[model samples]
Target chain A: MLSIQVIADVWDRHLITMRTIEHLHMFSIALILSIIIGVSVGVFIYMKPKTANPVLNFLNIVETIPDLALIVLLLPILKLGAGPTIAACVLYSILPIARNTYTGLKSVDEQYTYVAQAIGLSPREALMKVRIPMSLPLIAGGIRIALVFCMGVVTLGGLVAAGGLGTVLQNGIQLYQKDAILVAGLWTGLLAVLLDGFAGMIEKKLHERYGTW
Target chain B: MQTERLFDRIESIQFKGITKKYGEGFAVKELDLEIIGGELLILIGPSGSGKTTTLRMINRMIEQDEGSVTINGIDTKDADPVRLRRNIGYVIQNIGLFPHMTIRENIGLVPKIEKQNKKDIEERVKTLLDFVSLPPEMFMNRYPKQLSGGQQQRVGLARAMAMDPPLFLMDEPFGALDPILRKQLQKEFLKIKNEINRTIVFVTHDIEEALVLGDRIAIMDQGELVQVGPPEELIFNPANELVADIVDNQRKFKHMDTLKVKDLMSPFEDKYVLEAKMEACDAVDEMTDRDLETAFVFEGDELLGQVEIVDLMKCRDRGEKLSELAKPIKTFQPMDSVAFALSEMKNSGEYLAIVMNSKHPVGILVSDEVLLKLI
Candidate 1:
């Protein structure tokens, strides 16, 4: 059985509460920025469908690059802080959201657009009113997937001196403290799961409201 | 918000020398037609027959490659396509009511877009729901998925009518319903069409539907209109084999319910008439000359009665008048069903009946003679 005193000792020594807040703070910024950019890029590709393949291919290549290397690459310009960390988090999270948004927008039933046009909706109006609303369920799903990616990158942020749960994790590994690493890693994973659960609930709600299938 | 009046009542829709090409084949070729206002004209044919293509050209859903479409003497080319569509109501096979919208919202969409007042829109939606036989209180907030297909179609019609357009274009609007539901919708639609009384161009492949609903039916084959006329004319005198085939199919579809007395009635010939003041001997001579057993005795416009040859002969020997031997005959109106007329003829023990229009005998309905006309 796990002792309560061992958990408390690890918590006080690593300042677990403060680290969790920092992790969430970086995670929130990255997720919000990723959502805005991803959705815009998705809309842009949808408008000019010819650009879809090339833009998605380019994003696909970025997604394959190792997340740690992506952060290391940004260190030259964004130099040793949360800036490189957050940039890396946004970079990694965009593909799922952008790809999902584009696919969702493009895949709306032809019947909808045809009816929208027949009923005298302007092309732009139809996109905003019919296409986007119908796309909400899929979009929410994409954002949920992006949330997981953001959490992973933000946890990696502490390796570059960006304060988060990762800082406690790095300290435990460097100092060879077994309890610190276990507690910090487990806490980070638990926080990501809780955030994923919250996003899942939102996704389910949107699916019920706007899902076509 | 002040709503602006864009299009006036449509007096005529003329498709003059219109042609539309798709790849190597023609979807519609040099079609010419005139649709009168307040009449429901049906365009019907087989799968590739250009009926839908022709209907779409009116609102520029698919613009023609050559010639022009004009409404009320104004060329449709001069109008903005979107504005023209907004002014014309449209319905399709699938009853494409927005799935995410409430019934009231779907019905009010176009009017709201036109900048109509909110409270007025709600009231109008309620009235429109009632117009389509849906209770507004029970259905206003329901999404389309919650309703049955028939109910959704009614909401589709209500949405189209929201703009109060002068013309409506329907492309197989009720094609998605089951037979019973389709028949129900057709009856409801005819009632609604009667109430709204707007110009409509409808497209369908069902011949029975065309015959039942159209004031004038236009049949197309391989991108050209084979015939355009009232249903009776098309059945009696088809322009080509395709049209004859369609008419033949219509007979099969309706199971002869569409056949009426007007289709088989003939003009009441003067040779079969005996003047009311004529001598019985002259009446016998006239009836013998025509090789007939009976002649109608008429004094100008008044139908006195039918004079049988045997009765006329008896009167002739006594030197009596043809009017004195006249006997009453059964009469029927031209619009009655052929089956009803046949049953009447059987009940009255008469093979022939006078086809009348209220006070005047317009034609003659003969059982064997009309059956021979079908050949």
Candidate 2:
């Protein structure tokens, strides 16, 4: 029987802690950049609905490419490391955020926009004040999905020596260390659950504030 | 009224040889019409007959492909579309109160956009809420989703009037409501318009609504202005077959002008008067003795209001004076038609209409008497 001490020892390792921090840093940076790019693209497409299908299709195609293949494809330009791994994760994250944003914006009641125009709000003002605020719950939902998704894919960072829980699992498997593998996998799962729960809380709060729920 | 002077500035909207086309066909073709300021001019037609197109062109929502639409001789094209729209009130059938905004915020939007002071905006919102008959305290904090359809449309109207714009464009504003609510709103709107005196271009396909509400009815067919005139003129002297056909459907409203309030109302008498300081018990006793349901409560010759026998009986203090128990009277000039008086009586839920000559109450038109005349 594996002792609790064994699991505690692995959890206390400085190297694992460092890897966890690095994993969070990469995930957060990529997620932030993805959100900015994704939401911007979404707003652009919403303004001109004719471009929606083409743009979403292009992103859909990117999503279809395997995660490792996309990382490797970026390797030629960004080279192997945290850079290419984060870039690939960001690319993967964009599809959900962009798609959800586009759908949410499109779903906003057009009557409000018509009133916005009739009342003389410039189109830009209407989008910012009315459309975006009204679509917040759906937009936040998209962001939450993207965040959880990025957390899972970020584990793959260890494959390129980018340093995350994946590296611990990889070393454990290579050396046939059962306790090490179990601890690493368990922590990664816990981290994902924690981040997803946090995102869910945020989404709930946004919906409540906007009274959209 | 403050709104009376607001109408004097902009006399009318003139459309001169205006035309708008979509693809191959004209949406509105060579429309030449004049809408008098301070009156509700209803542009009514069948669906796709260009009533909406004409209304939109006034606000520059849909730019005219040719000719000009002028408000008080200043062409709409000369003004910035956004600025011009800000100065015009608009209401649509959907009653688009922003779901995200509270009723207070929705009603105060245009004033906020105009950069009015916060105190002024708040005051204006309260005033508009009262004007629309929605109590501020109960409705101001509630969101749009919290309101019923009729309540939402009332908020929509209050929002439109936030800036007190001289020109209003209502595109089937009450078309989506149920019949009962629609009639109630129509009456409320007529009352509001009478006080505000703003020029209004209202579009509707409902012939009854057009005939009942419009100061002048403009009938359109196939993007052409078939005729424009007062409801009575259009009924008595329709320009063509189409006009006659439309008016023929609403023949009852046509006979309204034949009898004036003077002909219908009974002359004022000392028996109908009650001193303001008279005790509630005494007032009730007097009404009971005369078998009267209502009597005008007066502070010597000046009409304070009217007191109902039911209201006087309900007074907690038998010693309370009639002045304390009386409700404000709804007065109309003797020149007003019996149709107008009956409608007013129906709307106010009052059985008596105080017919005034100048400011003094000359007569009282009992609801039963008017009904008898109509029968």
Candidate 3:
């Protein structure tokens, strides 16, 4: 067995490298896909609100389930590991973004819409130029929330043999290795804080650009 | 300011039996009206009277369930909506500027969308800024948030005009502002409308605004046209009692054009000018030298009556208070016709009004100032 010091020596070297890269890969994939799915779902809900209500309700139900249990439940169908873990995180991220988009798009002032129409802008043109542009700040805010939530969930997702800091954390916990656990948990926490802060800056920039409070 | 020639292309609007129905009741029904080219048409009505619905129908923003709206000569239905909108300018009360864009970008949007050259768009944006009284160099780079409400409105007007649309649809664009700002913007808008000569469909609830701005007024009730005519005709001869009440409230303000100092100027009588504490003694001496008989005792242009030699001696003898001694100066606005001046003189019991711009005097409205020269 490798001495604890040797594992410590490699901890910053091999383990951190693998954890950070894999963490980034899984986080990015989950975030991008979730955004795509969430926005599409949001747009659909916007266009067909009656249809959206039921669909959104179902997603809200899915979000209510505990993340670890949801992953374990997914393991039965997808057979464990990164696939199920990433899938569960993506599911968790959907509610905030999708709901946000729907609400934002719906809440744009009716007068602006009428004015756009009076200017002879077509339905599509009004939606793209007036409605969508006006809703961007709120939509972006929702996306930021969803992204931070996903980042946190994905770090925890490493519990399921996913190749991220969660893997290091799980091993360190099982093996009673204090240094190993400290490094993974601490880095994951730091990355979450960093990502959250970055998303916040982007949100502020968007609000300033769009003249939204 | 390019004054669109008085006879430019005769861009009239005609609505033939237009009707809009929502479920059981009609919003507008069988509405027939002809809007002349280069005329501002103000549409006034209580809320839910379908005035807005009618405004929207012209641009097909709200589809009329029946009849046709023709611009120039082309039926609105046949015109492609996008292309149609490109040829029409729209302004709303809230001044809905695109939040994400700078003023320049907002004004140049339709041009940019049509793939106009960048240089042309820039030039047009700059020219439009100057036309709207906003300096391009300062406002062009600023976003809507940086602008005040009135500034945003002017930008909105510039954007609407950028495409040089022959028709303008304004839905109470100044209604949200405070009364002072609304009046100022209304005056500015009149100047702009004169410059552009765009056929306008202006909607408002305030009768004073309607009479002040409209060449022809269309009053609507429950989606029906109650009356349509020049403001004078509407006021003098209303189609019904409802129309009469609206015109009644606006009558006093409308009489502004009828009141003039020339109609009521009493005269520059009294051998000597007023000698008041406010007036420098040397200034009084100068008036005496000029063969001006009566010095009108004025407390800052409130023409205190003629300071006759008798009143001056009374001041010297009894020491009359300046406020009591100063005569009331009758005033007349440039727009006020002679009739109003005579009435104001009679009612105020003062031959002259302190003609003022706001609170400060501009000129004396003596009785002789009447164009008739009766004074």
Candidate 4:
């Protein structure tokens, strides 16, 4: 008969691998969607600031909902798994990226815009050619922060038996399998750390290119 | 675009009771003026004097609270801002080349947006680059970041000229350069303007630049145009103390025209025949045939001083040989301005200053000639 510890070790190894992959999977989708939706919404608000306040206030209200309850409520409709998990992750990611985008684009120097116009560029031409290039670094930084935070939420998604690292953690909890829980926790931490480091390097490179904070 | 052919005849611009207010007070108040075409007009004043505000009103960049600006007999209030702006070229201190675009792309931008063919746009860009002396092969593909400030300003100039607009409004385009470079560029631009004659409305606070470039200058104070006139007229007779102070500094540059050697040359000086030591005996008679009153003797190519006929006659009486005189001829340096030469002439109390190249006297100018030309 296999020792319980031996079974626990096998569960621990499987949980580690699954959790790492799940964290990457959930965060990646959320981050990519946030970039597209966030940049668009940010640019829209930047173009018309008068209408942006109410929309930002609405997003602020949505952010007030508790993360776990929000996930559970989404579970019934999305039927648990990667879908509901991704939706929750994406919802959490937009606030920072969208806000950053709006602020960054809006803050491009007016003199730069005036120069572009005096040189005969239309408004859209000036924004795309001058303002956006200058503002991208700040927007990218916000996305980096959003991605790291979303990874943490994704591991929590594993609790719904979504086959993420949270599955091993939950199963280990049930049987008092200390090793299994430890491995699952270790992998989740490593995953968040590696992703964050990657994003940080990219953000730094972008900031250097655009000379922005 | 040549000045005479600009719309067959010059069109006069009229601003009718133009008023622009930020809040309670007016930024530009009930101002009325007329601007004639083919003239280089400079608008100058202190900060917040509405000089820029007035220029912007010409193209309607800022909406006037109450008033109408008419250009070429058309009411600017009813015209489309974009269309009006396109017809007029505008340049600012920043030289705003699009950061992401190549020089060619920035210069070619308006034509591209207007749906011109690729070939035509490329041709226009190349032509403009050449006209600005920034060759296309060297600068066309380079980004703005790669260019120096002066080069970028030239690119800005090229971009403004791309549309072949009849009117150009420049808001301190060279205001950001260091003074020396700014002066050099201003002088260089005069040569360029001689070739391309478009109606130019320039804005600047520097009085020297205004005096150098302006055919007519309009001085503004608190958004009001206090006076406008030709540079010479403005300097001699200012509208008030403000105008007088602005012109007082420009008087220095005017001295450049008065300091020529030809202006100081005299007609009545004893003529000296300039001759080489190797000149044959027949050449001595040749000098006398030319009605020489004196002879300037030389050794090989070196200048020896004046040998008067009286001195030679006295030498003949004493049974002595003819020789070169040891006196130095007063001379004016070629590069010295007429004013400096005149001052030097006055200081020395000399009737003439010899115009020279190094130690050689090229010509001579009298005090009376220099004084006549000073006016």
lDDT of 2 at B371: 38
The lowest-lDDT stretch of 10 consecutive residues in candidate 4 chain A is: A11-20
Ordered list by lDDT, greatest first? 1, 2, 3, 4
Best by DockQ: 3
Q: After superposition, how far is residue A85 of candidate 4 from its true place, in Å?
A: 1.5
Task: Please identify model 1 stretches exceeding 4 Å from their true place.
Answer: B1-3, B250-375
Q: How high is the lDDT of residue B86 in model 3?
A: 74
TM-score of each: 0.78, 0.77, 0.76, 0.71
How many clashing pairs in candidate 1?
A: 0
| CA deviation > 4 Å runs, candidate 4 | A1-25, A47-66, A120-122, A168-191, B1-10, B100-105, B115-123, B135-145, B250-338, B341-375
- Predicted candidate 3 versus true structure: per-residue lDDT over B161-204, tens digit per residue: 87787778898888876553465577678888888877899999
Instruction: Give per-residue CA lDDT, model 1, range A1-213, as digits (tens).
Output: 236888799999899899888888988999999999999999999999999999999999999999999999999999998999999888887888889999999889977988888878878878988899999988888899999988888888988989999999999999999888888888888888898999999998888888844
- Candidate 4: deviation at residue A178, Å? 6.0
Best model per lDDT: 1
Best of the candidates, TM-score: 1
Sorted on TM-score, highest at the top, how do the candidates line up? 1, 2, 3, 4
- lDDT, candidate 4, equals 0.71
* Candidate 3 chain B worst ten-residue window by lDDT: B366-375
lDDT of 2 by residue, B1-375 (tens): 111222334688999999999899989999999888788999998888899999999988899999999998889998877778878889988647887889998888766766778999999999988887666876799888776666778888888888778888999998987553465578668889899988899999887678778989999998999999887788779998888888766344445567688876678877778899999877765765554556788887788888765456566355898787778878888888777778777777776668889977788776532233344
